[model samples]
Target: MKRRLLLVSNSTLHGGGYLQHFASNLTRRILFVPYALHDRDAYSKTARDKFKTLGYEVDSVHETPDPVDAVRKAEGIFIGGGNTFRLLKSLYDSKLVTEIRKRVLEDGIPYMGSSAGTNVSTISINTTNDMPIVYPPTFAAIGLVPFNINPHYLDADPNSKHMGETREQRIVQYHEEPDTPCVLGLREGSMLLVEGSKATLLGSTKARLFQRGKHTTEYEPGSDLSFLLTDAQ
Candidate 1:
């Protein structure tokens, strides 16, 4: 089977329920990653309640002793939004990072993530907007996507008097390293769907792509972004 992935900018849009964007596509039996949130149980429960409404059973990996086995057995994986650093650290501490990569990449199972989850699903979490609440061994991630994701991407507020580095500037700084790949600035309500080597942008919002030296590009919804899959690392 082809590797299937849904990387979402956020679980809820301005007027939508949790995971409303994926309600129609979700299937039964999904493994939920809740370590990013401060309250793992609450976060998992919220996700469980939401998915349950759609007839999907959600299980949090935090409740399992053998997370690797859990990932191997799960039909699909759904990681919720929160702090990227915390999420990566939890995956490493549980030693399930490699197992997840294997199941989602080598094994070709369906996987989904939102916010911080989206951050870790990419090459690295270096582009995440969240502060480093805690430390992970490294910023490296699953590399499921060739580029990094900057979730909740914001454009410069022209009306604001507070002058700080714009989101664009920060991402450009992240790419200062000669080898960093492009960064996807996913606005709220935007998502990327990947099946095998193909990727497509979804939702009504436009997304920004930041590359080195070149001007950022805004991709319309339903645009074919499969080219990103083959981008050089």
Candidate 2:
């Protein structure tokens, strides 16, 4: 079976309603995972309400007794943004990683993720910008994609006086590690749509690519990124 994924950098764009940017691409029935946020109920309700506006129905895993079972029956899965550590911990606690991997990779269910949610869809959560408020058993994620992702990526402002490292510099640091996979700096309002072995950049902005020993490259909205899928392996 071919994997179907939509990895979004951010859910809400500036001056846009929740998920309004890609509303038309979502499945009609979605199983939402709200584990990243502290208040699961409120998060679930927010997702439910927003999805409703898009003519979609959401079933939050937090409300179910068997989240693994929910994954089995879901037509599609959507994981919302928040703290990456917390979300990974919750997924570990509930043991949904393997099940979700199976559902998307083998069962061909569509998997959508935003921000922190997008972080966990990669090889590991090491590239996430979120603080480690909680620890999971490991940083290993669903590995739906071969590379890592840095969501909400921002370009360095040349005029700013801040001394902190730029997003690109931090990703460069990640490449210092031996055998680390390539990283995609997914700018806000941008997304990667993957179908089987093909991946395409979508939405309003371009994405930055960081490879271990190569020059950083920029890809536009309609650029084909299938090479990242095959080349990274």
Candidate 3:
């Protein structure tokens, strides 16, 4: 059966937001997969509790005997955001990134992701402004989406000394690769509604679109997800 995926970093779970989107569509099947937590029990408690509150059958698998099989059976996968670097590392170490790509693109599984989750869907997660709390061998990502995603846009503190590079700066760096588009900056509360090969941003405000060595445009949310869609795949 086909499913709709909702990927996000944070949400209040009230109204028809991200949580409601998943909770309301419980019939098909739902999976709350968190990549932030290293502790298996912690991941279980965090994901299971929230999903169970919505009365859905949610399971957390820290290490699967066969990850490929597990992914194939899952109808919908909701990837929550945390540290982009950590998540990408886990994906590479566990070989879940390949399985995820197959399930979402080749197998046609509806996939949802937010923030860090969205960052990993692109070719690489280097553009994210979050600190590299953890490191993995490779910088490769799921590559389900072409453009990198910068979550929590327009809200970053200008005075912070977090080091690394800002989203804008990263995109400027990305411009070094003329072939690669800069990145897509998504504000909180914004989501991409993707069906089959088509995608559209659904929200009130427009997202910021940036390209390396190019212009930046403020695209209204729900305008047309085609930009992200084209960039992602």
Candidate 4:
């Protein structure tokens, strides 16, 4: 099986956009899952427009009873970025995550996701701040990959206090887990491409790897990221 997965940060899929170009030559039928959007109509329209711009026949399964059917038929699945908690909740409630795991792991259909989509590749979504913003049922992720993604990574702030913890601090708290999943801090244009069991980092700027309750070295962009995963073993 030709197994592959393209995990990216957030982006609008325009005609000449990064996602559109990457997916253009691969397949014509791209089924987009946009469960992250709380507003149904807004989500559906976004899905339609993005896929249409990418020259794909888009379908929004939010109104359908058999979203799994759509998942099974698609040549590729593109999961858009939004609220991570919301995305996982919808998948959990609909039992779509299970089907997705089988599709990518068993069937070898290429899986592509940005932001929240990338978050679901790990074993859990507890690390996401989007959780507190929206109360979604916390469930283990699909485990398509072992690493937890922290997209839109930014430096810690030393400004006047806002009272609660910052994103960086939250991530620090997440590291206290008994067995921490490798952290991949990706910028907006950053991505991790997995073919077989190897994952390669593709994009501009460096990606930070965090593990064992400590901040690891920064990985220069445009390099093979397989070492990050294999080295963990």
Best to worst by TM-score, what's the order? 2, 1, 4, 3
Cα lDDT of model 1 by residue, 1-233, tens digit: 36788888984312134344443464568899998899989998998887877677888998998987888898788888888899999888888778888888887778888899899999999999887999999989988878888988898999989788999889989778788788989998888888888888887699999887778899998999988888662
* TM-score of every prediction relative to native: 0.93, 0.93, 0.81, 0.87
Residue pairs of candidate 4 with colliding backbone atoms: none
Candidate 3 Cα outliers beyond 4 Å, as residue runs: 1-5, 9-16, 19-28, 155-166, 231-233
Minimum summed lDDT over a 10-residue window in model 4 is located at 10-19
Tens-digit lDDT track of model 2 for 168-216: 8899998999999999999998889898999989889999999999999
How big is the positional error of residue 223 in model 2, measured in Å on the Cα after superposition? Answer: 0.2
Q: Residue-wise lDDT of candidate 4 within 31-115, one digit each (tens)?
A: 7787877786687687777677657776666756688887777778877777887788888888788888998889888788877
Question: What clash pairs does model 1 have?
Answer: none
Residue by residue across 1-233, what tens digits does model 3's lDDT show? 23244545343222135555644644445555566555656765666666666665665546456655667777667666667788788777767888888877776676767677777777787677667888888877887766666766664468998886665666667778757755667777776666555567776556777776668877776666665555443
After the best TM-score superposition of candidate 2, give how far the Cα of residue 195 lies from its true spot, in angstroms.
Answer: 0.6
* Error of model 1, residue 81, in angstroms: 0.6
Q: Sorted by lDDT, highest first, which candidate order results?
A: 2, 1, 4, 3
Model 2, stretches more than 4 Å misplaced?
11-27, 231-233
